[model samples]
Target: MIVVVDSNFLQNPMLETYFNESATNKVVIIDYAAMEAFKGDTLTSVVKSTAILRRFPRQVLIAHGTKTVGRLTGTREEIAKAMINDEGTAEFREFSAHLDRYERGVRPDGVERQLLDTGRWATDHLNAAQAENANLLDVFKELTDGIFTKEEISKIRRGEQEEGWVAKGFGLVRDLASDLLSRHPDGSVKLDPKDYYNNFIFRMSLCVFVQLMDWIRVGSPSALKPARLLNDRVDAMFATYGTYFDDVLSLDKQMLRTFWETDAILRFVYAREHEK
Candidate 1:
């Protein structure tokens, strides 16, 4: 069992005694970022509290702040040294830039609009087709054998499961695009769909890339190839929906990448893997 040592607990002598004497020796010290969230009386006290917490085995203490949360096991010392020495590595710099962009609301070209528009279009088409004619339902029924139920459609309308539609449509579009790309003997990329759709690939690509970044941050290099392959499908998705929803599909891939890389789980995994 992992134990989280907050500044409050660290400052209290009794709590510290209990903590040290506890059968579970695993204790992780919360980092400055997380400590900042506390509405404490003084920063000095918090810092002292953190220092006391860190007196344990360096490998047992992890950092848990607002923006950064990772096990301190092995990576903590290196990470601390990097911060103290101001050695901002390329990846760290890139991650910082991504966060800056996100904070400023700087998004990809048209990704947001495309998602909204596609969602609206799907909703409208499904509604109109269902009400006026049985043909739409028949088509869906033929394809899914009633697996896609009316309740599911209703849930989608309520925004309960909108991702399901996006996932399904994206999968279909990606498959078709893949087939086309594979057939091209010259290897010259065909009239890609994003150009027509106004950069739908940008949005889809960002999502895929972010997913990959998250996987990497979690120290799961084994998943890298599959993640990259998923990213490659963004081009195909663009081809399928680029014409219909270009403006809404442009997304800032860089920001998403940064957010995932900085995620707590990624840092935790990194710490676990590098533990001595």
Candidate 2:
């Protein structure tokens, strides 16, 4: 039997001992990501390390993070947008123009960079997860299922009926951006209107991506209307990448498990060494 423990519970050494003394079992501890979320902490690190060592015998556990899988999935979409321009469209050119401007001695504000970095991080994790598992799609599905609900996506669509939801959603993104900016070593810088606009576009794309992932993970027939609308918009943007998209969509659970294991271990090691 395999026992999985949440990072919160795993922090207690006694709890780990209790499991260790039990019958012959294999342990898989998850969620080394929690350490990053909380920053470096000794207790979390120890728990993470202990769990990893027991990987050969009993399963140890940790919490992934506060951000739901659906949220991360949405972030993945946003990163993909930055990495892959719309197949052959005017927006593609527009996006290129923005990048050109940034490359030509145009420094983006802290918020913009933070948002971009966040998207990149999410993408890295997603790709890592996929590479680790043969069946990446199923794992993606499971992780996403835990974060988004059909009702939430429906609310987003209904929000389209009113302007407030868009404002609220944008507000949420902006607030998150602002928070990230505040933490940067350097203070925020003034941004050109065009650069700001580009950031907004990327931000919105990320929000939509996150919402759609939530829909895909938890959506039902009731969510079909909004899901269809969102899917149409995304599909219209990248018609030729259908096969690649489908391949990603079909990932399996094993990939997800491996993603968690590897991520957890790396995070655990990082936390342990850095905590002191």
Candidate 3:
């Protein structure tokens, strides 16, 4: 089966062995952060980095947009120059730059804290909306009659069955998130009611947002550690793409559980400590 391995699996000797033994399989390794650090202004350094990405053919699943590069290189000479520039800039990609830390078994501090904070605000805002608008559920239920039961609506209100409910309604959720979380070029997030096919990063961001909301729905204060949450959320962002793969191997238990609970029928293997 085509298996996707997250960066964490690379650190575990046993898991690495598992991966090595399955070399013939269609294995993919992805680090979204690495790709993300490039979706900005294409400076000299950015061009240099994009060139390095082309070298790793099998490992990287995505590449920088050509249109994006063209924007930075208005002249054909500049474009051609960037195409030939082969100075290694792997260190510029955020995830690749963090390889040393990963090898040392160190975690990034305070990463994705803003996302968690934003999610907390979103939850509070959603709860407030439901409270202030008493007929909200009934109105939605009437509009989506026969699609969602009244009991299901009640469970959703209590955040008791959102995971199962949302999984069952992924197309609906995708449409909603697409409308609600589209990013504007001015570095702002806005709704794109008519556009859902473009903007890969925003789509992935919505997926992560939905997954994090699920965590908040059932999470206790003690269970939501910031560092761990950041790690898991980033891992979840990476794992979202794994939904398309045949199977996914992960050393992170939370990631394995996250994929298993999603609508995506992704086979997940939880890597365990192997005997010496």
Candidate 4:
């Protein structure tokens, strides 16, 4: 089996023992920075050195970062607006035009190169996911408008007990965007939100984000959302990519709850055990 474990799992040394006993298993660890450190190393080497199961051969994969997938799916304008909320569309377009300068090492002095590098990487990934998932767009276009039966919403609220229900609900979520995209003068040219927003990693991140927002609204209506807390949640959202593997092992209750609510297909090892 393949498994995805949050980095926090490394704090518990006992977990390594369980993984070591299973030689056939593959494990993946997600992080915003881990991918850079393992740049030239083999997957096995990185896994053995950094992952929970050192004795086992390195059989791991890496999802790049929190916003990487999210930024990749939408229209250029949409992505820019999401990243720079205060900026007007024309202003963002002007900012994006500097990519060539940044690439040519013409960036202003004292600017953090890492941030620029990340931007470039995200841009590249966005193009790639678009090309790869382009065929899937038509599949999403067939979805009904944002409306769902009361029973469907009830099941979605109850969380992922049924197969296809979460996917159907996601179709509704995409409808919010699709409805707008459908208004183009060329009615045949509709962009499917899932084609961009619900790509493997982005979908998981969104699920966690939506669930967290719901909690924040209910738990502390007056509280200001802190930057660090939001960043932490984004970090945890990367764990959703664990669905690509066999199972996800996350310690954060919020992340676990979000995963459950989404009815993601991946198994949640710790959550299942905790229930008993």
Q: Estimate, for each residue in 1-276, the C-alpha lDDT of model 4 and write its tens digit.
A: 656566545445655754666766655545433432233333322333344433342434444444443434454334422332222323323433443355457777644454445445644543454454444323333443244455654554555345565555445555534443444343423335335443434445446435534433354212423433444444445455543445566566665566554544222422554488
Model 1, 58-155: lDDT tens digits are 22433322122111112323433322212222333443344345435775676445434544554454345335433422432343343335565455
Top candidate by TM-score: 4
**For model 1, how big is the CA root-mean-square deviation?**
20.6
Predicted candidate 2 versus true structure: per-residue lDDT over 134-227, tens digit per residue: 4423533443453434565566555433345434444444454455344434444344433432232323333333444334445442334433
For every candidate in turn, the CA RMSD to the true structure comes to 20.6, 22.4, 14.4, 14.9
100-164, model 3: which lDDT tens digit per residue?
34435665664334324534554454345335445433433343455545666567557675655
Residue range with the least summed lDDT across 10 consecutive positions in model 2: 241-250
Give the poorly placed runs of model 1, Cα more than 4 Å off: 22-24, 30-33, 37-43, 57-60, 64-276
Give the range where candidate 3 is weakest over 10 consecutive residues by summed lDDT. Answer: 266-275
**Count of residue pairs whose backbone atoms collide, per candidate:** 20, 20, 0, 2
Query: Please, what is the whole-model Cα lDDT of each candidate in the order they appear?
Result: 0.36, 0.36, 0.43, 0.45
TM-score of each: 0.21, 0.23, 0.41, 0.43
Location of the lowest summed lDDT over 10 successive residues in candidate 1: 240-249
Q: Give the TM-score of candidate 4.
A: 0.43
* Winner of 1 and 3 under lDDT: 3
* Ten contiguous residues with the weakest lDDT in model 4: 80-89
